[model samples]
Target: MPRIPFVIPLLLSLLGLAACSPPPTLDQQLYIWQRQWRPAHVEALAQTRLDFSTLRVLALQAHPKAGWARAYPDLQLLKRDGRPLVAVVRLDGQLPQLDPRAIGEQITSLLHDWQAAGIQLAGLEIDHDCATARLPAYAALLQDLRRQLPAELKLSITALPAWLASDQLEPLLASVDSSVLQVHAVSDPRRGLFDAEQAQHWAAEYAARSPSPFLLALPAYGVALLDSPAGAPRVEGEAPLRQGGTRRELQADPQHVASLLAELRDDPPPGLSGIIWFRLPLAGDRRAWPIDTLLAVVRGQPLRPALDLHAQQNGQLSELQLVNRGNLASALPAHIELPAQGCTAADGLGAYRVTSTPQGLRFTRQHPGQLAAGSQRALGWARCTQIDQGGLHVEL
Candidate 1:
């Protein structure tokens, strides 16, 4: 055989090295922030087991006026999965001061209660939105909490991007085993929920300052901003607010976030351990991405929207439903038409209105709405002697 040229052999060696290099390791976790447990959590927890290795649950919240309120999470459901859990204690940003010892005692008591209930706790995460000026004081509090926590339990903090501006941030992070830098809803509500570029910049800066490994908390949910007479817009999250005004909905796009994840995975920042998704999506959660959509983003799969019309028939009655059969959430179609003859009655349901047409019944969208991935909604009902299922039409 002819001897290989020097450049060819060198190129082959480089390719071989590249092929042998293992991809970066990034752990995925979830935040369960519901104040009260629901029956839906059982299914949500089961679906997330394979993709998410840990769960950071909101266990206690401390408010200025209300004092402390423990979250009513279903302990049995949480413990059944056997995934490592992190109890998140939220201290209201308006809190005037910090009594490290007292707060530490409260956390320890809650930990004991959870342990007795058979929860496999791996850590405690302090979620406090203290001002940048308070970093030194916050660091001191973490130090005290660290000393108080059980040796096996890791201590972490939900760090703010604003903290990057403070010189004391390094010390604050030093007090904990790790930190989670929240990159969503940190700016003006009018600007929207998440900015991929801004998030990447924050991650890079955080990775530089953090002495220990840290995770990035990204949004998997949406919120409505209702204009109020007050200076600030009222935010509607999982629950609706009594106040009414022109609503502007903001959601973090799954494709945008998926692209960001790809960038991070390709060139991961130092001390960046993983991603922790904000609030796991639950059934009947109007403001969250469908669980399937979130999973697709996590797995770096393509996002595709598939919306179709399905008619369920029983005798002369037909239930018209819009089904989203893709891994991406889709906006409701503007109009849906079903060809029919000798129709006795037809009416739209939900965000649609029906009108009788020459050839069929037209279902026009009355209000804007989203049909989550892998979900179906009843569009309307029609009772006709001759309804054509094959003639169904939809305008997106």
Candidate 2:
């Protein structure tokens, strides 16, 4: 028998047509980075109450070191969704050595492939965090891409906060149909990354000087920085992120986004087309904001934090449960004390040294960790020497 070959669906992109509906007079769009191929994204889009005219999907990544491009493995387009989709190709590796011709060829090939899949694209986007000094080279690459693509295809780029200060900004913005100002990232987590006031200032300043309409890209995901005793927060390393010791460098909650939007709405920036979330929130992402939170924020509603604690007992073991019922993360209690007396270490709680405190028997997190939003964690079990109808009482 002949060996069988693996087969997967190709991405279908329809460029030059962006709006999901009959009318193209929409203002805002959503960007979806393809982390995996799951029908849940399209389902989420269909189910979401948020109003978005288009969806910008990550299609390819161009690497300068290898001088090659790689297409996303999991992304597959569906013919039925009415929303328009724009393919976004992220350029990575060394900034200066990026070959415009090579990148353009990759884009051209992707355009053909997606076109064959019957995907109607509204435009194409280039996402690159270029260095200030390398703006000229980046501009040159965009120009080449522009020439390579059809005249009807709108071109866009993702801009950085630092780029607004550079003299190259004007020329750079002039080269594309529009630019997305990413306001969510932090250069130093220890100094606090997301500042609404600072972001407002940047948006106003850039919008005033922008030659074309721009999209303000805000973060929907959270960042975890390694907290050091040396008073510096470092980026995640090769090792797995250890909970409890890490700090929430930035909290991109609905309330914060609403505040920013409210401020921006008061005096809308010049040349500001609309807002583009850094990502479309998914259920599996531990750090991504909940869909409810995203929709509420879009609708200018308030957010909340809900933390619930429950107790259960089995034989000599007593269990304490912590559940985050809200859309935002809840800080784990520094220590939890139970109402029972004469409680000693048992089960996994023994590792944390379950001991008697002044109030009662306490279990402390050996390392501090944030309980994820809409997640449940068992605080472990304590073998209390005594029990009563009063039940397990946990004091934070």
Candidate 3:
């Protein structure tokens, strides 16, 4: 007798499981774009982290919570519970010219009223792009707003990383107390994170000259869709699982994130303040990925030195080790040594065509090869560069 086919039922079973699977817990500092925040999703995420007294959920509320608290009027423009939230106004362009002083007064008064209602605020977060050039006049607005604002409330402004530059820097900087350097990876369809990284580098340059402290806003959200060709920047959300621009199912690869943190642990930049993540959400991870990887970094928690970068004894192009010794996850650029080759300092590092193996040992990275997670191999021809002395430069 012929056996019954199993594919149809199996597919239905998976669909049911997908529907029934419980949403993950939300533990990060919570914010709401309202446009994207679903009521149930909000409740699901909020309820999960609420019991953990160690964590505080701050809502960056763009749209007020619907019936947030029974005691408070819904959309009353007041605080619910006790956390401070950023009130984000949605502007889809459309304005021909904004009167700087008038607009400033209007927002300031509304914010004051919100403050009076016992609502705390980090600051007003504005989201706009190249059009934000109106910021010089807007700076005048912020100046007045800043003068009137409660001293404790900080100011914030958001700008797309792609277009931010030295010329536009001063005007935007003058407008706010802080900067959210949005690595808007999606705006560039050709290459996502490459553009994003370029944005960050340029932002860092402009930010260095500006007066405001800018938080690099890496995309916590995934790429809306993958529209580019091969060899684009690492996928938007997290590494590994989301590589090549896959969305929603993104994850912060523990190994990748861990490597980056290790470098920072090894070599920290002077005058750098602190690293802020784009969000605190359910993480939507069923496997319960290590959030502590980032938490440990944030707390200045000590981590072990797992991934070691060393010059190969072979003298050919050596593989660089991007390893994860800590229990938590981190991220790092698969660094080739400084362009100058044949340089080995007291510290074990070299420049050019370097790589590491899966066992966390140094090897050679090739022109056509890659070092992912726990593995290493050699790549390309190793020609000796002129300069040869000094330890490898690392950021811990």
Question: Could you give the C-alpha RMSD of every candidate to the true structure, in order shown?
Answer: 3.1, 14.2, 23.4
Q: After superposition, how far is residue 207 of candidate 3 from its true place, in Å?
A: 4.6
Question: lDDT for every model?
Answer: 0.91, 0.71, 0.43
lDDT of 2 by residue, 115-171 (tens): 877776789999888788999988888887888889999999988888877899999
Q: What 10-residue stretch in candidate 3 is worst by lDDT?
A: 65-74
Worst 10 residues of 2 by lDDT: 7-16
* C-alpha-based local distance difference test score of model 1: 0.91
**106-169: candidate 1 lDDT, tens digit per residue:** 8989988998998878898999999999989989898878888888889889999998988999
Candidate 1 residues lying further than 4 Å off, grouped into runs, are 1-22, 342-344, 355-359
Angstrom error of the Cα, residue 279, model 2: value is 2.0
Ranked candidates (lDDT, high to low) = 1, 2, 3
Q: Kindly indicate the candidate among 1 and 2 with the higher TM-score.
A: 1
Q: State TM-scores per candidate.
A: 0.91, 0.75, 0.45
- For all candidates, what are the clash counts? 0, 9, 35
Q: Determine which window of 10 residues in candidate 1 has minimal summed lDDT.
A: 238-247
Which regions of candidate 3 deviate over 4 angstroms?
1-30, 36-84, 90-96, 99-102, 105-113, 131-135, 147-152, 162-164, 193-200, 226-271, 282-396
